[model samples]
Target: MQLLSPTATTYSELQNAYEHFNKVLFDNALPACLITLQREKRTCGYFSAQRWANVEGQFTDEIALNPAYFAVTPIVETMQTLVHEMVHLWQHHFGKPGRGRYHNDEWANKMESIGLMPSSTGQPGGKRTGDHMGDYAVEGGRFLMACQALLTAQFKLSWYDRFPAEEHVAHGQASYASQLSDPAAAISPAQANQALANVVKPTVKAARQSEDGTSLQAPNRSNRIKYTCPSCAQQVWGKPGLRLLCGGENCDSIPFV
Candidate 1:
């Protein structure tokens, strides 16, 4: 047997997660960025704008996840930190970013649109935007659907840092956080919505099965869900595991991909 390739197993998993989340949550609109493991004390993770460039002069933003807290926090919770930074990246490229490290209203709204609620304390009713902030996963939200899809596909980070950080936060609703992070509907539209809301039915997809050999149950939502308002062409993306329609004013068209 060949020895395992550590970097391939580790970093590549994060890269895959970034791409997967980009498609599922952001309508594949967010630009590609760097995913790095960092050891910053008391920091779960961070997003630095235009932090790196290749010899060819391509610049990409950087998202550094503190590996120290990986083992202390649930894996899904840790992934939540990754996504929190991703929201910063989203604002940096597509929306108005707050000055310095402050999280602005646009970023906060975007986070809510994606089913991640901003909070200063990482829980409900916490401040929505600030220099220091965290988020909790929303019930029956897009982020949960995305996470379920990833899990159904058997994607995971193969390696984790041995040392943990001092500051640890359980950033999502873990079952809520899971779809958004490691915890589970476990990530598709149906079961993810069902798991989060207990409404939609779950489906079975390609994957490793249970001990009895039955296929595992997953969410109903698939990847790359998009909707466009017919009258205004106002597009929106999400995977709520519910029937989607163009919700523009006077444009309630019930069509989608």
Candidate 2:
């Protein structure tokens, strides 16, 4: 380590330290994204903001995502959102946008190819609430996310070819329920239900369809409750019991038990 250190006062030394510190800070703040991009075969940069004018977009040489858009959102959703933005950046480099026009069918297809896009599911924005928007607008956003996890985690799909929803949920994605679960305790019925519901009903399915073939699946008219636990406000699946359970390891509450 000392050999690379020219004098501590050297511009090279100072620059290296600064760059190293920045990398550490950024990576720690967004570790999952950093790791995913490393595995992907694309060149780009990502940064989180308080909020974004658009959910995601491509600049001259980067893709920017705002975690604030879904600040209270699950980690998988955030990842999927960022991946969606990254795909657009890729389109800027790989496809023909005809000029400054960025969002188009080409970009949309790219999302589907990798399974980053949601399957058609529930309502518009999938399941809109005060904090986070819903998943896909159709009915199979969960299935899509599952498929996406299989593609990316198992088949090693590129970031451009995957959806963040499934990736976060699969293999126990902690991003979705980190605050809601007892990491080491028995998965609560309510927590489990929420996870299942989110898995089954993805947000991307809720988007409005376009005639231009940009939308992944045709929206369905299904009106399920989206299975959320009333206690923690987590999306759940399964025939829920009377009691609510927390997903956190330190705190598992059986409200009715």
| Candidate No. with top TM-score | 1
| Candidate 1 structure lDDT | 0.58
lDDT of each: 0.58, 0.31
What are the per-residue Cα lDDT tens digits for candidate 2 across 188-239?
A: 2223343333333222211221112111221122322133342454554432
TM-score of each: 0.64, 0.31
Q: By summed lDDT, which 10 consecutive residues of candidate 1 come out lowest? A: 208-217
> How does residue 43 of candidate 2 score in lDDT?
13
Over 1-257, each residue of candidate 1 has an lDDT whose tens digit, in order, gives 98659986788888888888888887889888888876654456788889899999999998887654454344555667777788888888887887777788998898898888887766577788777777777777787667667868987655544322111211111223433334243232211221222221122221222111000112233433333333454556665332355566675553321
**Model 1 stretches astray by more than 4 angstroms:** 1-4, 165-257
Per model, how many backbone clashes are there? 16, 40
